[model samples]
Target chain A: MSTADRRRLLGPIDASPLYSDITPKVHSSVGEAGKSDKEVRKVFIKTGLVSNASGSSYIEASNIIVEVSVFGPRPIRGSFTDRASFSVECKFLPYLKQPQEDLFRGDTHANNNGRQGLTEVEHKISQYVETAFLPCIILEKYPKSTIDVFITVISTGNTTAPSSILNLTNWIVNCSSLALIDSGIEIKDIVTSGHIKYLQSEQRLIVDPLENEEREDALDCLVSFESLKNDEIVGLWIDGNQKLLTEELLSKFIKECSSMSEKIRANFNNYLLKLCEN
Target chain B: MQEVDQISFPPEVLSRIAPDLSLERHLKLGLRPCLRSFSEFKPIAVSSPALEDEPNLVGSSIVSHGQTKVICGISIGVVEAKNQSDTLNQNETNSQDSKSDGEYDAEPVYPVVDIARGRTGAPTEEEMILSQRLYEWVLQSKIIPASALLTNPGVAIANQTSSSQGSSADVTILYPEDSDMPDLFSRVKPYKFVLYVHLKVFGRSGPLFDPCHAALIGALKNTRLPRIYVPDSSIYSIKIPIRSRGNFGHRVKETRIFIDENQDLSNPLQLNKDNIGGASNYGLYDLSPGSTSMDVDPNVIILADLEGDAEEAECMSKLNLIYNPNKKSINNISYSGGGMVLTKDTLKQCFKLAKKRAENTQ
Candidate 1:
C-alpha cells in the first residue's frame, strides 16, 4: 500500500482496474451527409449577456453553442507595455466531449493519466483566434494593459469526428469579434471566419460541411478575414488527410472561405444596423 | 481617473463593485445575472458512456449543465479479506455488521474531484467538500449494493495431464462452481472490488455538486465488473541475494492473480437503481418589501441551478435536493440557511420542483 495523502482522501492502494468482456458497440451513421454543400445551419447571435463582464456574446450555430466574454484594458500592476497585450483562452465544458478526443486528447503517451493544462485542441483554437483578431484590434490605443478574450464552448452537438472543430472554431472567432465590438474596444475592423471541406473523391468543395459528412481523405480549411481591409486574411489553418497541396488548390480553398466570410459579414452588418437603430 | 470615477458606473461595473445590489436589480426584472429566471434550471446534457476501451476504466460519463461540465471515470481495485476464515460467514457477518452500524448493505465509492483552474497543488476546499459530500450521499442513498462487489475467482489447468507436464498447450479454465472442479477454491479467501471515481470539472460557472452527482450516477449506471481469477500454479518461493545492500537473501512468495481477458465473462454491476435520483440545487433569496411587485411581506424566491458569481456569493440560503421519481421519495436534502430563515412553504416548494426535475430526468 502507498502512503496516504494527508490533505485528501485517497482510495484503496491495492486496487486494479477491472477488465470488461464485452465488445464495444459500433455507432450508426447520423445521416448528416445528406446536407447540401452550399447550405449552412441557422445561426443565432446575442451580445452583452454576462452582466459582470466588460462585454460578452453568445452564439449558437448548427449544433455548437459558444459564449465569449471580454475582460480587459483594465490596469495591470506589472511592467508596462506601449500597446495592450492580447490573449485568448478557449475552454470547453468538461463534459462536452472534444472532437476526435480519443485520437488526440493527450499530447504525450500518458493516455488516460488525466491531462493537465489546455489540451492541444483548445490551445490551437485559442492561438488561431488570437492570431485572427490581433491585427483587427487597435491594441495601441489601450497602452499598458491586457485585453483578454475567454471563449467557453457550451456544446459540440455530440460530434466525435476531428473535422467538426473547424466549423466550431469559425463560430468561435465570429462570436469573439462580436464580443469585442460590444466591449466598445477600438478596432480597425471586424474579423469574421469561414470553414470549407474539399472532398478528394468527389473533386468538390463543401462550404460549412456538417460533422457527419467528414471523411478521412477530406481536406478541411478554416480562414479568418478582415472584409473591410480588402479581404485581407488574418488567420489560416488547414487539416488534410492525404491530399497533396498545390498553389492553385490552396488559392481555390481560400477563395471559397473568403466568399463564406462575405456572407457572414453581411449578416453581421444587418445585425449591427438593427442594434444602431435600437 | 477623476472624471471617470465621478460619473455613475455602467451596469457591468456596478455588478463587480456591488454584486448584491446588481443581483437585486436583476431579480426585480425576474432574471438573474446569467439571464436565468427564478425556478428555471440550466438544461443538462449527458453524453453516452465514455472510454469504453480504456484498459484502466470500468465506466465513464460526461455531463454538462449550462456552461459547466463534469467528466467522471470509474476504475476498480481488489483487496483480499484480512482473515482467511471470514469467507465462510461473509454474508451473515455483513448483515450483522449493517445492523450494528444502523445502515444498509451498501458501499460508497472513493471519488477525487479535480477542478481545472489553471493551477496545480492540493485539492481546493470546494473540491474536497464536494467529494466528501458525494461520498456521504452515495452511502446514505445505498445506491451501490455491497453484495454486487464480491468477486469469484477461477483457475485454469491443462486438460491433458501429459500436456500439462510437457508443452502445457491445452489449458482449461474452471470456475469455482464448475461441476468438474467443485472444491478448487474451497480454501481460498473471498476478494472484493473497490470502485474509484475520478471527476474532472471544466469551465465551472457555479456550484459543482449537482453536475458532479449527475455524472457519477450516469457512470455507475453503465459500469461492468470484470472477472478476475487466481492462477492454477504452485506458490513457489524465490530467494534473491542483495550483495550491494550487504543483506542476507530474503524469500519472495508468488501469489499473483490475473484478470480474465475474455470479456464474455464480465457482468454488469448491479446498482440500486431506485435510489439513484436527479439532483437539483436551489438558492433562496428574499425579495424584500418594495422590491419587484412585492410591497408588504418579504417574499422568498427559489432559484434553481445557481450560476455566476453574484448569485453564488450573494445568495445566503441554499438547498440541495435529490428526488427519485420511481420510488416517489426524496433521497436527500441539504439546506444551509446562512443567517437567513426558511419557511415551511419554501421547503415544500423546493420539494415540488425537485420532483418535477426528477420526472424530467427519468
Candidate 2:
C-alpha cells in the first residue's frame, strides 16, 4: 500500500487493529519495513514504544512501561548439555504502598518474599515473558549456566499507555544486556514485543493504549516478536480476551508481527555489529 | 591546674575567645569582647567548682556557637518506688539478659516513662533520643551507686501501703548460697533520682547563642551540685558540642567539643554527632571535691546538635524569638527571651530578683 493508503487505513491515532489509540509520540519511534522512519512516511502501525534492550526491544501498548534486559551467550561452566538456562527477578520500590487489601493477602504471598516487590503487575508481565520469550531464544548453545534477566516497570502511568508489556519487555532486555556485559556474554539476536487493546467505546482501533483507556476500554491484545530462522514461536505474547475477532483483524495482528520482527532483527544485528566493532 | 579528672575546653580554646576564660572564669571573670571584636563573640573566664554541691555530680559548660540567651538545664529528682525502686541493685543489666532489643528489664521494670504534665506540643525526636540516651547511659554505667537504690523494708512511696507483695527490691534467692544468705539487704547510702532537663530557647532577646554551648553552660552552672571523683584516678571524659553552623545552613551536626582541665583548648576533638569519630576522644581534670568526689560522678549532659537558619530566620521567628538566630553570626550575644538576657540594666535587675528569691528560700 502507498503511504496515503496506509495512513487512511490506520485512520487518526484512534484507528488500529486494536482498541487503544497509537499515540503520535509513541508510533513514530518504530521503523517501517524496507523504509526508515522518515522514508516510510511514519506509518501509524509501527511499534514505536518498543524500548531498545541489550538485544531485545519491548513495545508497550497498554498501561505499563516495560524494559527488558537480555544477558548471556557467555561460556557455560558446569553442565555440558546443549541447552542453556535463564532466570528473571523483578523488583519494585518498597514505599509504594498499594491500596487494595485483597490484592496483598493469601495467593499474593506465594510470589512475595515479604518485601522483594515483584508487584502484581510485574507478575502479569513476567507470566507473559516466561510463556513467550523463553521459548524462542536459543539456549542449547550455552548449556550449563544461567542467564539472569531483570524486567522492571517503573510506572504504569495511570493505566492508559500499553506501558506494562512494553516497558517490561524493555527492562528485561536492557538488564539482560547489562548482566551479559558483566558476565562477558555475546548473542546472535535480540527480542521485542508489541501490544494492542480493543476499545469498545470509540469503535476505533488504537495501537498503544494510554493508562486511562486501559481502565475504560473493554479488551486488549499483546504480541511479542523475535526474528525466526525457522517457523517456530520465539519471544512473543498474544494476550487478548477479544472474543469476536474478524479473520482480517487476526491476520493484521499476526502480519504486523513479521514487520516488527524484521525491525527487531535488524536492530539487533546492527547493535551486535556496533558492539563487536567496539 | 588540677590533675586530669574530666574533659573540658582547652585554654587555647578559651583563647579562641581571646579573653581566655575558664568555667569559673567565664562566670567570675565577667564578659570581655572577643578578639573577633564581635561583642557577641566575647569570652569570659571559667573555673569549675571547689565546693561540694549536688553530691557525685559531673557537669560542664561550653560556650555555644551562639551566644544567645538559650539555656539548657538538667535537674535530678529522687522518688521512692512503690514497687520497684530506681536502679540501685548490683544486678548488671546486659544485652545477654535482654529478651529482645526493645524490652526493658523485667524485675526492676524501670519504665522509661515520660511525663507530659503541663506541656503543649508533642515531644520532639531529639528530646526523645536524648532521654533514651540517658536511659542507656544509666543502664551501661556504674556511676550511680547501686546502694542508693536500696528500699526501706515495708515502706513504699504510695498513698496507701499493701501488706503483702509490697514495693521492695524483689530479690530472688537462688540456692541461698548454701541456705545461709540473708533474705533482705539495705543500702549503706541512699539516693533516688529522675533527671529533668529543660532547654529553654528564650525568644532571641540576647546575642546569638548556640544551644549546644548554652547546654554546656547549663551543665557548667549545674556543677553547683555535688560531684564525686576518687583520688588518683585518671579522668577520661568527653565534652560534646552540637555543630549548628555549616554550608548547608541548618544541618544539625554535633562534634565533641572535648575539653581537659590541664590541656589548652587550642586543639580538641571535632566529633561527628552520635559518636561516629570513635575511641579517640578527650579527657579532663577531676573536679569532684574531697571524699565526696570518691563516690559522686558528675551528672551527664548531652547537647542537641546545632540547627540552621530554618530554626533561626524561620522556625524561631514563628516562636516570636525577638532576636533572629539568622543573619547574626552565633557568638556570645546575650538574648532576652525567657527574660534573663535583657539589656545589662534589666539583666542586673533580674539577677537581683533571683538572688532575693534564693534568700527567701534559705
Candidate 3:
C-alpha cells in the first residue's frame, strides 16, 4: 500500500533550473547602522483580515510575516465538556525555509509535498503558542465548545540567529492575542510577549534582538505575560549555553523581558483605541 | 449511601477528575503521588553498554529513570562535502567557544524520538516537540565535533607487481591534514559521517524530555564511527538530458562511498565532554493559601523530577534546566508559567536543585 502522492506531478530529476542573469538585490537589515539596540523594529499589525474566519490578524515585522486566524466558541460534536477545548496548529509555506532548519530538522526529502503533516518546527511553535494562551483565555465561559488557532507563516526572515524561532514565536503570540480579541473571546487579559538576546561577555542585553553572530554566545529568552494579572508570566522559553547563567543574569532576563512586553502592550492599547474610534 | 459515594471517591478516581485537589492532598502529607519527597529525584540507571555490541548501531544506550525507560541508538551515513573550502571558511569565521573552537567543526545529530504507547501512526505531538528540542540543544551545546565524523577516504591502487594480479586492490587512506596529493587524490572528494539517532521510550511517565536527553548523551558518549573509503574509480561522469528552457544537456560527476567492515579500525566519536549536560524538570505548584497543615509563607513549591499523569496534568507551570556539573554552568532553561508566577526565589531554587542533581549523577 503506497501512500505517495499520485495526483501532484513532481519535477523531472535531471531538470536544470532556469537561470536569471539579473543579480539579486539584498535588502538592508532591520536594524540599520547607528540604531540603538534597545529600539525594536517597527511592526505592522492589522486584524480582521480573513473574511471567512471569526477573527484574523496579519502582522509584518521586518522580513518576518505571519497571519493568524481564530475559529471557535462554536459547538462541538463530541461529548459534553465543562470547558472549551483549545488547540493550535501552525504551518509554514512549503517553500519557506526556516532558520537553521537543516541543523534541527534534517529530513528535507519530504519538504516538496504540500500535503505532508506539520514539520517539527511547526509543531514546536504551535505548542509554545498554545501553552502561552491556555492560561490567559477564559475557556469556561464557552462551555461545550472548542477554540482553534491556525497560524500561517508566510516568511520566517533571513536572520541566521539561533533565536530566530523565538523571535517568530514572539510575533505569533502577539498576533494570536489580537485575533482572539477580535473574535470577542473572553480572555482575562491581552497576552503580549517579548524576546531578548543577552551577551555574556559584553554584559549587555539587546531588547528584541533581530540578529545574532555565530562568534558571540548569547542567551535568548522569550517571555509572555498577561500584564493585567499582576504582570504574571504566562509562557517562557530560554535558549543558549547555561555556563554563562548566574542568579543575577537570570533575574535581569526576566526584568528586561517584562519591560519589553510592557512596551508592546502600550502599542497594542493604542492600536485597540484606534480600532474603537473607527 | 448514594450521596456519600458522590462526595468521596477512590484516590485514583479523584486523581483523574480533579488532579489539582489530588496533588494538594499528597503535598499535605509531605510526599508526591509517586511517593517521592518534594525535592527528591528519580535515580537514573544506565544499561551497561549492551547495545554497543550491535553491528548496525554505531553507539546505543538504554537509560531508566525510575519506571521510565529510554533507549537511544545511533547509526551512521556518509555525505560528500559539496565544497570543502566553504565549510572550512565558515568554521574559521564562527570560532568562539572553547568547546567548538575554530580549529574543529561541530554539527548536530538527526534525532527521532518514538514513545511506545501501543499505537502506530505518525509521531505524536509530544514526540515531535521533544525530538526538535533535543536537536536544537545538541547544536547549541556544540557537543559533537565535525572532525570526529570527518572521514579519511581510502583510494584503491592496483598491485601490478604482485603475482595475484587480479586480486584485491591496495587502498591508500588520506587523513584530513594530508596535503601530498596523488593524481587520484584530485578526483577524491571529502566525505563526512552523519549520525542518525533513534530514541524509543517505554513506561512513559511525567515529562519525557529530561530522560530522553539523558539517554541521548549516554549513547553519544560511547559512539565509535567506522572508517569509510571511496574507490579510486568511484567517480564517474554521466550526461543527462536537461529539461530546462535554457539548457540542452548537463554532465554530473558522482562518487559512491563504502564503509570498512573491519571492526578494529573504527575511531571513537570525539565529544565536548564538558559541555554535555543532563536535563532536570521541576513543576511549580502554588498551595491554595491555607490548604497545607503547616504554615509555609512562600506557598509556591518546586517539585523535582515530575512523574505520573496526575502531576503532569495539574502542574502547568514547569521549569526545565540542563546543568553541566563540571563547569557548574547551566546550558538551557525553559520555564513556562501556566498559573503560578515564577519568582526570582523559585527560579534560583530550581537552578540550585538541578545543579545538585547533575553533580550527583556524575
lDDT of 3 by residue, B1-362 (tens): 45554478899898888888899999988889889999999989776344322333677787888867676777665666555874455445434444335455568886777665533356688887888888889888888866556655665444446554334433344434454556656656666666767676755777889888988898888888776665455222234453445765554343445555456778888788978887899998777645644333387878999888778877779889999986789989998756566677888899999999888887
- Order of all candidates by lDDT, from best down to worst? 1, 3, 2
Q: How many clashing residue pairs are found in candidate 3?
A: 2
Cα deviation of B37, candidate 1, in Å:
13
A97-143, model 3: which lDDT tens digit per residue? Answer: 55555444332332232135677778889999999999988998989
User: Could you give candidate 2's per-residue lDDT for residues A1-278 as a string of tens digits?
Assistant: 11322101111221111001111122222222243211111211111111222232232323233333444444556647667776565533221222232245322211111233355655665665665546644566667755655553332332223433443343344334323433434443344444444455665554433322234444444455544544334544444344656677666655554454455445555655665797
Best by lDDT: 1
CA RMSD for every model? 9.0, 30.5, 25.0
Per-residue lDDT value at B44 in model 1 = 89
**Please, what is the TM-score per model?**
0.60, 0.31, 0.51
lDDT by residue for model 2 (B1-362), tens: 86988756676565444332343243233322222210121222223322111111223332223333223333322333433433333244432333233333321101111211112234445344434443343343222333332222211122123444433232121121233333322321222223333333322212222233234333533333221111110111223343454634444322111111111211111111121100000001122223233232342110011122211221121110111122221111222123111234433333333233222221
> Which portions of model 1 miss their true places by more than 4 Å?
A1-31, A41-75, A91-113, A152-168, A178-186, A211-218, A241-243, A268-278, B1-124, B146-270, B273-362
lDDT of each: 0.75, 0.32, 0.72
Superposed model 2: Cα runs more than 4 Å off: A1-82, A96-102, A105-120, A158-188, A215-217, A228-232, A235-241, A257-278, B1-362
Interface RMSDs of all predictions?
A: 7.4, 36.0, 19.4
Q: Stretches of candidate 3 above 4 Å error?
A: A1-278, B1-7, B52-56, B82-105, B158-181, B234-254, B289-297
lDDT string, candidate 1, B1-362, tens digits = 55555667799999999999999999999888888779888998888543433444667888988877677877666777544445556577666754554344778887878775533457799988998999998888888877677776776554544633423345455687654656777755578877777787766788988899999998888888777766555321234443335555644443444556556887888887867898999998887734544232247778999998899888888999999998899988898857456667788889999999978976
